[model samples]
Target: MSRTASDQSLDGLADGSSVVVVSPERIDPDARVRDFDQLSASAQRLFVSEEETNPATAADLDPGDVVRFTDYYRVR
Candidate 1:
C-alpha cells in the first residue's frame, strides 16, 4: 500500500496522539466514530497497521500510527 499525503502527515507523531479512526465498513449513518484514545484496548488493537508489509496490528501503532484500508483513503 502506497502512502498518501495524509499518511505521510502522521509520521513522527508523539505517542498517544489523538486520532479520529474511521472504518470504511462502519460508514453508515448510525455507525459510531471515535478517536483513538477513546477506543477500548481491544478495539484499538483491531485496526490494520499502516505497515502493510509487516505483521504489526494496531497494537503496535504508536509514535507514528495510521490505519490502512483496502478500499478507502484517509479523510482529513
Candidate 2:
C-alpha cells in the first residue's frame, strides 16, 4: 500500500505505530471508530467496540486510535 504523507510520518517511529488492519472480511476487536454508521453491522461490532456502549463519542479513545484514524481516514 502507498503511504500518504501522514502515513509516512509513522514509518520509522521508535515505539512503532499500533495498527488495526480492517479487511473486508473482518475488523480488529479493539479499534475505537469515529464514524460507526459508515461500517456494516459486523464491522461495527468488531471494529467499534467502544461505540457499542459509548455511541458516537470519542472520549474513551486511546491516543493511538485517534492518530491512526486521522492518518488513515484523513479526518483533518
Candidate 3:
C-alpha cells in the first residue's frame, strides 16, 4: 500500500525522538464511511503502526511536528 506523508515521516523518526499523535475530527459530512468492521480494521492498522514507530514523549512537540490522521476511511 502507498504511504501517506505522515506515514513516511513516522518511518524516518528516530526511536526516541519526541512526537505527537493527532486524530482530527472528520469534517466532511457528505463523505461516505465504511461499515463498523472496516473502520475498526483501519483503527487497528493505525495502532499497530504507532506501536512500531514507538516515538518518545509528547511533552515538547514542535509547532509543526505532528502525526495527524484526518480521514478515517482513507487510513489504510
Candidate 4:
C-alpha cells in the first residue's frame, strides 16, 4: 500500500499515541515508503517456541560409544 505525502501528514496521526516502530524516514512528507515484506505475529506451538533441550544434557552414553583422552595433546 502507498500513502501520498499529504495522506501521511501528522493530521492523520492521533495525539499522544503513535506506532512504536514508525520509520524515521516516514517523518518526512516528501518521502514515500512501501513495505514489500513485514513481520506478523502468530502464536507458535511450544514444539517450535520452547527451548530445544540439549540431547547431551543428563545423558548416559553406552560404554562402547564413550571415548576419553588422558592427554590434552591428543586434542591437537
Q: lDDT of each prediction vs. the true structure?
A: 0.39, 0.35, 0.34, 0.22
TM-score-sorted candidate list, best first: 1, 2, 3, 4
Residue pairs with colliding backbones in model 3 are none
Model 1 residue 19 distance off true place after TM-score fit, in angstroms: 15
**Tens digit per residue, CA lDDT, model 4, 1-76:** 0111222443553432111123343333542322212111221121112343211122231111111212100000
The TM-score leader among the candidates is 1
Q: Write the per-residue lDDT of candidate 1 for residues 16-76, one digit (tens) a residue.
A: 2234333465455553334555545653444433532221233434423334444433332
- Candidate 1, lDDT over the whole model: 0.39
By lDDT, rank the candidates, best first.
Answer: 1, 2, 3, 4
What is the Cα-based lDDT of residue 27 in candidate 3?
A: 23
Q: Kindly indicate the candidate among 2 and 3 with the higher lDDT.
A: 2
What's the count of clashing pairs in each model shown?
A: 0, 0, 0, 0
Please list the residue runs of candidate 4 whose C-alpha ends up more than 4 Å from where it truly belongs after superposition: 1-14, 19-37, 40-76
- Residue by residue across 1-76, what tens digits does model 3's lDDT show? 1223333344454543333332345223443433323334444354335453322122322223333334322222
Residue 40, candidate 1: alpha-carbon lDDT:
52
C-alpha RMSD in Å of predicted model 3 compared with the true structure? 12.5
Q: What is the TM-score (0 to 1) of candidate 4?
A: 0.15
User: Evaluated with lDDT, which candidate comes out highest?
Assistant: 1
Tens-digit lDDT string for candidate 2 (14-43): 433233333322333564445545544653
Candidate 2 off by > 4 Å: 1-4, 12-29, 36-58, 66-76
RMSD of each: 11.3, 11.0, 12.5, 24.6
